[model samples]
Target chain A: MTLNNFIRIFITIIFANYINSKINFFITDYYLNFTLGFLVFSYWVFTLEEHLYALPSFCIGLSIDLLSGSPFGLNALLFSISSYIIHSYRYSFKIFSFLQVTIFFAFLSMFYLGFIHIFMNTANFSYLLIFLSFFLNGIAWIFIYILMNRFKKIFYK
Target chain B: MARIAPGNTPKLGYFVLIILASLFLYLDIQYKTFTSTKNFFNAGLIATNLAINNIVFSPISNLYKLTNNKLALINSNELLVEELELSKSENFLILNKDKLFNDNSELYKFINNISNDYPHEIATISSFDTNLYKCCDNHRLHLFNNSSPFKKGGTVINSTGIIGQISDSNNKVSEVILISDINHSIPIKSNAFFCNASGSGRPKVLECKYDPSLWKESFEIGRIFYSSGLGGIFPEGIMIGSIISIENVEDGDILLNIKSIANPLTQKNVIVLYPNDIK
Candidate 1:
């Protein structure tokens, strides 16, 4: 990646951190729209290469752990596993279209959130939350992917 | 973008890390290592939040000052005039009485009477965990600290009503076991009945287990409950909550559903009670 691309990614990561701090997941409330936003961010991290993305995911998880006052390293483990899954599968899948990527990410995001529900021993894992999270993440990913594509078109050319 | 193949060895390492972190978290929960870590984390978080709050509020505050300058000045002048009138009245009361010295003695006596009611000093809640479970446990520790003048099991409160009893205390912060914890049992009473109200781990709710024979009439919704002061943890007549509902079962047991009058979630300030004789 060029220096400018690297800087753009760094800025995006900072923006995500700020957003995470401002938004409450409402893990307390049974269902909320904020969880969907979290899933979208998680999916974006998942699509990236492991070596390049693992460090950012780790930082994101650490920031969350600090901000949420959860037991240290809880998010670290969850995000690490999610990114690892995406990295492992990234090569086999063809990058046919934005829709395909969105569907793939939605599946992974659901699995990520499902794993958290089981780990936390919540009363019920709202399928609505899971499905809505995927849909929202898909919507967010379109904007991000479009921006990345545009950047690639103008600068990479 | 170039992608690298993941080796089996690194994946195994990640799995091991997950297992190890999970074990640490579980052990921390069971053994309470998280308590100290939570305190340290809270201190940092409080500092950061304060800085953020200042930054965010500064602009709004400045704007308000600019727009409301005349209003604020008028209000301050009014307050000063009221203070002057009150002080002049107090001075007249002092000078007009032949036995003004007795009034000083009476004032001293009043202060002495209230001084013993609260021996331990009040502490501010500087920071709290965003996660409810973590917040609950941290609050429990803050009330329970040994150093607090509150008896091993004495009640804590704010200006409004009872919060929880002193479960533990330390030099800096005391652990407060909230009324919502499963382990808490407070002896409470109403005008017509007395019972032990137990916590069910739900916020703002308590279950009062009363003897069926004690009640001449069935407990109804909206019946107010008060601290019986039988357990010596709380002072008598403090408002607990009104009875939200009641159920009597076939086994002759009675359950009174109570909601606390004071919402602990929104309480930014609290007072710790120390028995009169502690000094």
Candidate 2:
């Protein structure tokens, strides 16, 4: 990676950690842990054409697992699988509609939250949050995509 | 132009990484091996937070404290004034301690009989049915103590004189049958004339029917009466009350209505003297 790309990743990790901490502290009290940090890292890695996804994805998931107080490699395992699937389907997404992409993002978010809910909070986990977060993450993807595009334009301009 | 994506994902590589990650997770959860790692990371995060709090939040808070010095001083002054008033009241209690007890010469002897170290307590009436006290024969009262337990058969007195005895006691509350309860009677002394005065079912009223021919002096109104302590229930020579009326009828019985000095309505807080055997 170039110096510029390294700086971007460093800042994005710090910013994602800050947002994840805030969401867990304030917003995720009774809801699902939105996995904002892992999602941000996944979005950045998947959009880039470098084909070097697994290493960066593992690092991001491990950082989130440490910050989130989950089992050490729980997020790493799940995030790695999701990133691989998205990378393989990236060419297919070129012809996909916006609703189809949103549905795909919703499905991925639901599976992620539901899987963790089964292991981490089995006693009181609500499947309702998994379904609700499916919609929320679908909407959030649009914002994340626009913001990344804006950053790319500013950085490359 | 957008670059072409990778035609396929590396399934074998992904499988290998998943297996490795799953093994790490299994070791973490099953053996808690990562607790120390998590604790170390937590300690680092906490140290970072404390540093930021010191560098960012502390100066702002110090500035606030500096600006609020006048408010703190004002609060301190108010607290000091309240404390001074409480101390003044306590000082008044210390000065007038003797006057709170009655003017009986046998007071010290009576207290010594109860206990050499004086182990009695002061209690107030928590509940007294005034309507029933005036009209009913029971005249029971509930007493509460912040000091010690008021035992059953303990003597109850006020600043003026002996009023009654406690009929029941527990950790929380005690019941007292006042001197005016119809079932109650106190042995009294009046110039070698002794009789048991029974309650008249009225506040501060007790009636004693005696043979007028026994004592040389005729029954006189306003004559002083005192507890003789003959029954071992009450302390002797406590000024109980003065005679209010003497009526002689055809039955040859002298009916006397002696008024009590300690009115339960007037003097609310009474002293309880617990006997040594019941202590």
- Top candidate, metric TM-score: 1
lDDT tens digits, residues B1-279, model 2? 234477767677778888888887999979978866764665466557667889999777757866987656755786786565434333322333354234544555554454552346667666565534542355667676456557778887765566788876555566788898877999988777898988876668888888767756676789888787777777667677889988886668788999987677755566777556666
True contacts kept of each: 0.17, 0.41
For candidate 1, the lDDT comes to: 0.57
Give the candidate number with the greatest lDDT. Answer: 2
Clashing pairs in 2: none
Off by over 4 Å in 1: A1-30, A36-41, A50-63, A92-157, B1-9, B48-114, B120-123, B128-156, B165-177, B181-185, B191-196, B209-217, B246-255, B265-267, B276-279
Residue by residue across A60-138, what tens digits does model 1's lDDT show?
6655655555556666667767667666656545544657767766666567666555444243346676667666656
Give each prediction's DockQ, rounded to 2 decimals: 0.23, 0.15
